[model samples]
Target: MKKTFDLVFFLLLFALVTACSPTKFATEMAIDALTGAGSSTAFTGESDPELAAQSLPFALKMYEALLVDHPDHPALLSAAGEGFVSYANAFCQLPASMESSWEKQRHMLQRAASLYLRGRDYALRALETRHDGCIRLLNEKRYDEALENCSKEDVSDLYWAAAGWFGAISAEGFNMRRMAEAPTAYALLVRALSLDEGFNYGALHELAIAVLPALPEAMRYRPNVAPADDPVRTWEADYYHGLGIDPISDPYRAAYHHFERSLKLGEEGLVSPFVAYAEAVCVPQQDYEGFRAMLEKGLAVDMETRPDSRLVNTLQAEKARWLLAHAEDFFVVIPDEQSEE
Candidate 1:
């Protein structure tokens, strides 16, 4: 009788334990379901930046809530990190760029910086979770292992980590503390470039293009300039620097090449590359015709077919429109094409 009674008691205990466990387990499962569903909806609704801007906060909260219970979930970490980056880029940094008030601009920029740092930290956390001791490896300058340890599949994490780091550095502007992090960001993206040059339709190349041209002469490491007998060898010179032969390296050409490669990789449906090429390369070079052609290329993209890219293209197209409107500010008139002769 005691043996039978003990068996019944243990069975009841087992049932009690499982029944109690299901509440937390089921809640977590529900959170996971909600997160995936919300993310899918957000991706589908990509046409309006304002709508994205409005919805991101809620999505971020959902990610954070999930993270509280499931801190090491790679998907959650990535979503949180990318969410912060998208928010800062679309809402914070863009507006901050336009705030002419010194004090207000400074305030806006600082907020953007905070968001970038948060994103960077979250992305780093995701990496650390993926690879044990990764943070220590990175800090110790064990870049070989840090870069090699991650497989090709981890490209998004690497890219976003670099993006967030660079975003923070850019927002800091001249602040020496954050500016020092640029090389770290550069290394991260370089690793991503090595893993997949075609990642995100050449977004990796776009990022490197932005950084390469803006590198301070001191920070830029380049090979010795080739002899003048071989002008073609000039192309062999590192774009960021050229052994001081030119005093300042001309990275713009190389940057432009990346933009072209990006467009080719993108094939169609992406307009940001065109806008970026015009603003960062053509306009600065005073190539009015090239600038106009690039913007027209951006405007020509059909946003509906590429709905997933619509929001970014919309924002980029607006910039292209603004640049066209202010064309006179960037270029000088040559009177007539034949007059140049």
Candidate 2:
């Protein structure tokens, strides 16, 4: 199936090149052929990380090249958006996290942020194509106005745009301008969730575990600041109302709720929920045992059981193993041998 699709794609490309000028029908056919279901499944379902890492750059560049001709092509735009985010996460951000060299890590994170924003722009452009003036409203900070017209069909664009935007913000770390835009990403995700809570096997919920926890940092909440003077508090009061949780007293509750939902929806076939929960929830709460247990569960996952998710599952498992190996770096107190006995 994959070979047949590739052959057809190249034939289309050959036609486009050999002709005096590329016809619209040929270009459209090429776009569809390149971004077809077979291509997506073949790449995603591969188990080899090294192969994926090496191949993804080429694939991503191809998507970009194709986009120059077909700017408004939905499939190409979605592929670009989703591919860049996955590439940044699995290749850039994850590697940066594991790096010991501060300068190298910083450089890698910056690269990740750039890629994430690029992905976000592609996804947002796709959304704009679907709903004109939405991006303009978003830029003007009229989030509610921007998202008002978004419906269920827009969930993929919404999710990828928000994911890439949020990923960029997280990678950049505490830039006030980017931090200010966090609410916009949150609004996008919230809208996506409202439209389809079950999108991508509860991926919306998995993302909430990270995004909700970062609200405090994103808002720049200072413990010394008075409630009346604190923008973070006010923002939380307004935003948290819809999510059904108090950020001031317990910001992690919503994250936990989402974590449970994600785990249930994803089932034992997936490793991401465990890994996300451990890093996002356990580390902050200083639940060392919980952290260890979660990583163990992730590591124990059989990749063969879900061949389509093998690539992602492997990456998540690698992260889980790394976290466990570096557990001492996060925790101040270690239990002695006698205590364990």
Candidate 3:
């Protein structure tokens, strides 16, 4: 709940872990590795994104191999769930977000939908591991009922689950069944937002920027997502959030500073901030050159120099390329036709 990945708590937690068996030792190791800045789950340092991307398969298999023996290990479940979400984010969704061709984009979205759902399942496992019977209740469509059993400590896993669910629903396109599932995901996210807007340094807000706006325009600001009572904090939340208000109508005075803060807070070299600003603000305002410049800046970030999020940077840079190529799709150009005759 306090976040910052309290190393002390885990140290004490696993101190009692005798690790009498190899399985137990392995699980303990996985937890430790996750906390490491260089681990696949950690995504920190100047590690090569390509190398990191390549290593993920083995890393996931590492988790799965352990899960076979310790199905209910909370740390393992949390790491694995978060890992899957990151994988989908950096892999499946990146291409989907960038694909200019509708048919290809649809195919990619379908693929992304499955990975996101798998991530959601793992998140649910983590949640249920933490809060008994929560997943079972969730399976029966009792989301709020299930969430009632959660506390502030549950925010990370809740964000993971709802993020995956919402992303899957978003990529899968509009349908009655998917629409029906939205409220549950909505409730989970709102709760997570309330509990920890600082989770991963407003990473949840990155999701919120997309999630809140994806709803019908009229319903964007439901009671659940109302600004906090404290005006300053509410304003701060809105700014760091990727979209940062109506980019179309409002110039978003603090948008640049907001993104700068977001990058400083969590993603220094990550491509997400660049891509987020490009799509959320640039496209809406029809600032083609600005969008291109933002993307170019993201591309220029050296993975070897400041590899905060290599896979994400690489993937999002790819997105920037696609957007540049498809610039006309998002902005209109007035044909300089003359015929004054």
Candidate 4:
């Protein structure tokens, strides 16, 4: 009788434990599987851009569904946020920019902005998991205080959030609310850079190069030019000094510094830095020659060499070609041999 009672007790205890926590165990297992190395490789390793774009929405939705079960899962939140940002850029924003019809372009850009904000929210939530009151601080406009909570481990969240925010700002035109929030996004990016300047091979620098040019003048760094022979002066020092502006800043100097840094970090493997510098820097200056040279350089990058980044490289190459073809639309003065003669 005693032996039988002991066995019954053990069985009852095991059943109670399993019945009470099975859902938790299952959710944990799903999260682990979703975040495993093989999961990301399956997507990044895909060679076909169209196929990847078609399938990505489903994958993003699946991530959202998983987040429903694991609301505070930082990895899931970050992955989902990054997915939305990537989808918005590759599918919506790029296509919109190339759309010929004004109405279609505007509509697509609006949709892209909405998607970017969704991604930004998810990334912010992920940051909240790591630093509980950071979101509250951000809302209160205490941006620096909120960012202080972040550490090196939070760099990915910071980067994705800032990227999405900037994308939304650019996509939505001059919407006051987003424009107001630009400082917060800038703070997030700057904090991420401080924590890890080399993260993702200077992705932060690339982003800075693209967005700094568009920021409001008040938000820019406009320190007085340092002495010509200052031993501690960096490259930006020389650039600003050459511009011959005292107590003034050419936003382009900041953009160019990062442009150079990104190229050095990305080297030959990445194509976007070239395209970004061309569009953001050269086009504005109407330097058609510089623009053509940069796009051609980007086009020459062989995507097959970096199989993991093939999709991005392929997309950027397409953009470079399109920009080259549309060069007439961007420049007011296109020099020809006849004109030179």
TM-score of each: 0.77, 0.87, 0.70, 0.83
lDDT of 4 by residue, 190-305 (tens): 77876777787778988987887767544432224333532212222333455453222466777777777787776667789899989888988889988999999888887776
Model 4 superposed RMSD (Cα): 9.4
Provide the lowest-lDDT 10-residue window in model 1.
230-239
Q: Candidate 4's error at 191, in angstroms?
A: 0.8
State, as a TM-score between 0 and 1, how close model 3 is to the true structure.
Answer: 0.70
Instruction: Kindly state the number of residue pairs that clash in model 3.
Output: 0
State the local distance difference test value for candidate 4. 0.77
Q: Evaluate model 1: give its lDDT.
A: 0.69
Give lDDT: candidate 4, residue 25. 54
How many angstroms is residue 141 displaced in model 3 relative to the true structure, after the best TM-score fit? 5.9
lDDT of 2 by residue, 46-137 (tens): 78889989978877887787788778887888889988988998899988999999999999999999999999998998888888898898
Report the C-alpha lDDT of model 1 over 1-341, residue by residue, as the tens digit: 23432443354355468774334655454445544534444443477777777766765775676687689988788778877877777678766765558898888788888998888778888888878887677666455566666777778878888888888888889988677666557667767766677887788877766676676644432224324532212322433244343423567866776787788787677888887777677766788888889899899988775666677778877777877877787788623557676
Better of 1 and 2 by TM-score: 2
- Model 3 agreement with the true structure over 64-156: per-residue lDDT tens digits: 666777788777777777777777776677767766688898887888788788878878888887778887776665544677567778887
**Per the 3 Å backbone cut-off, how many clashing residue pairs does candidate 2 have?**
0
Return whichever of 3 and 4 wins on TM-score: 4
What order do you get sorting by TM-score, best first? 2, 4, 1, 3
Off by over 4 Å in 4: 1-26, 219-248, 337-341
lDDT (C-alpha, whole model) for all candidates: 0.69, 0.80, 0.65, 0.77
